[model samples]
Target: MSSSVPHAKPGGRAAAGAARAASPSIIVIGVGMKMRGDGGFGAAVIEALRAYPAVVDRVRLAACDGEPARMIDLWQGYRCALVLDAVRGGSERHGFVYRRELDPEVGDFGAQPGGTSHAVGLGAAARLAHVMDRLPGRLILYAVHGRDFRLGAPLSGPVAQAVPELAARIGREVLGALAAAAAGAGKPAKGG
Candidate 1:
């Protein structure tokens, strides 16, 4: 991951507060690289989400380059952030969705010499955000097991086929989070 942090104005606090007041609950940052096969999953999910009218007003969609610092910059103003990425976790055959709550204490995943090419890795960005006290209390990572990361125009078979399902799952998760937040706010919850 690159260490170049995208510089945002110091006014992120006010923007965050205003976003919170105007939205249903949280923000979603879809991190992906279109040139890298399955790595484009995040972008695909966002496209799917855009077709859903129910969520258009409640969520903010951002397409990231998978650079850790850039990712952090994108997430700076949300109450909760859900990061979607493609991972070669060796569990693709099991057809499972990999989800993890990233601990801000763990620095960037790409910090290691041979780690992913993502600049500054997601873990590192999360840690930096935490240290800066700018991290959302609830941050979730959804990693879809990927079969290929090769430079290509399309996703590998397994990952490509998983797109619709992944999109639906993300949609459900977002709805659930929103409903829960609403309930906590003493408002009638609408969706599951």
Candidate 2:
């Protein structure tokens, strides 16, 4: 199954304007279900970001059901896509946030059986999209450490406490990307 995510139109003054105007744009995808304790961290980050006016109008946020296909659709057309999800990798302790280039060759992502409720695996979706020439210019995967996937309505203690730090880091990254994009466009960097 394929899906298409909507894109935001660029906004700013004409080239002749005195000041540089950066277009507000960003796509943040949080993938998880509410019942799976720490698995819901993605959604929590989205919720927190929504309350910030500075980012609310600049970023497009979506809650995905941990499905790669849906995530791909939701991220299409955005210049940058940040995927937030809970991951189970034995190398790291719970609640740790790790950022790295998504490598399809070395990870538990390959052995996972069955399509997630959303239709594909995270690694597969990204790899396929890149191979198919559909990936955004900037794609990032943020895996939040999760210890419990047990059925419940609340986040586990570790995951719950990491929300603020994660959200702040994401916000900063998004803003920095936007600024960089604007700079590359030959406009003065925003806030410079």
Give all candidates' CA lDDT scores. Answer: 0.67, 0.68
Q: Estimate each model's TM-score.
A: 0.76, 0.74
Superposition TM-score, candidate 1 onto the true structure = 0.76
Q: Which candidate achieves the best TM-score against the true structure?
A: 1
Runs in model 2 with CA error above 4 Å?
1-24, 103-120, 187-192
List all candidate RMSDs to the true structure: 6.1, 7.7
lDDT of 2 by residue, 109-166 (tens): 3333222323355777787777666676567777777877777858878888888888
What clash count does candidate 2 reach?
A: 0
Model 1 agreement with the true structure over 43-124: per-residue lDDT tens digits: 7777777887766677776778777667766666667788877765562462345677856565333222122335555677
